[model samples]
Target: MFMEEVELFAVSALHNTATSPRLKELKVQQENDEVISRVLQYVRSGWPTYLPSHEILLRPYFECRSRLSTIDDILVLDSRIVIPHAERLAVLDKIHSGHLGITKCRSRAAQSVWWPNMSQQIAEMVKKCESCRKESNVQQPLSFVLSFLVVLGKN
Candidate 1:
């Protein structure tokens, strides 16, 4: 989704807290640093109970933007850390397709990796996308006759 949409959704979420019971329930499903922080804030403000899990907090937030459901559904709270299932699936798909080596996959999955590899992976996926491939051409170099014709005078 576009960054504008994401920002707008986030702002809307913060603005209308009334329709957030589902959101609250979702957030309560996972425990993460952000959830803990919010929970702590609530406690400081005098709430007696601990905050819900990050997943609990995320459900309503994601539901607010349906496009994000695919990504949200795969996320799990593991010892307070959020894991992305899409990235894992992408890596697995790449490996299965013989596009990525196990070592490269592991390296790419590491926290500190930069954008180059990720961009490469995205490019590869785009190239392999059947819908896109069917509609697009893999442009090739013109033959000498075709190339030289442009230099010749028009009839």
Candidate 2:
């Protein structure tokens, strides 16, 4: 059920003119990615039920086998683009461009793109950003605000 919503959003995102130029570049990059190419093949053909020792590297793709598919030759997981490893960093940058923090960045990424360990990568990126850390440190009032809310709720 949630996959349906994601697919709908992905289709809409692709139709959005603001991102078309970048999407074109992404398509070319995805095609050139050896791993993504192999994954695409797996998506097109039936995925093997069991991975031989040599195919161990594909375990991540295998895990989400049911959700994998292709739209216009671009591999997708449900409706989200299966970002190639080469583009993951760039995608993460765009996701965190507003410095909105880890949760928002992950939400933004979830809306349009995906890859293995995407949430973990977002957390790491936000943690490493000095500006984000400084902002987080200055949030001493957050605890006070929560306490105040709790006190008010008990009245």
Highest TM-score: which candidate?
Answer: 2
Candidate 2 whole-model C-alpha lDDT, 0 to 1: 0.78
Off by over 4 Å in 2: 1-9, 12-21, 140-155
**Runs off by more than 4 Å, candidate 1:** 1-3, 7-116, 138-148
lDDT per residue as tens, model 2, 5-113 = 4445477656752334456566788889887888777788888878667877678888898999876667788878888899788777878888989999888788778
lDDT for each residue of candidate 1 in 62-115, tens digit (9 for 90 to 100): 332222211122222221112222233433354325334334444433322111
Q: Clashing residue pairs in candidate 2, if any?
A: none
Candidate 2: residue 24 Cα off by (Å): 3.3
> On a 0 to 100 scale, what is the lDDT of residue 134 in model 2?
90
TM-score of each: 0.26, 0.79
TM-score of 1: 0.26
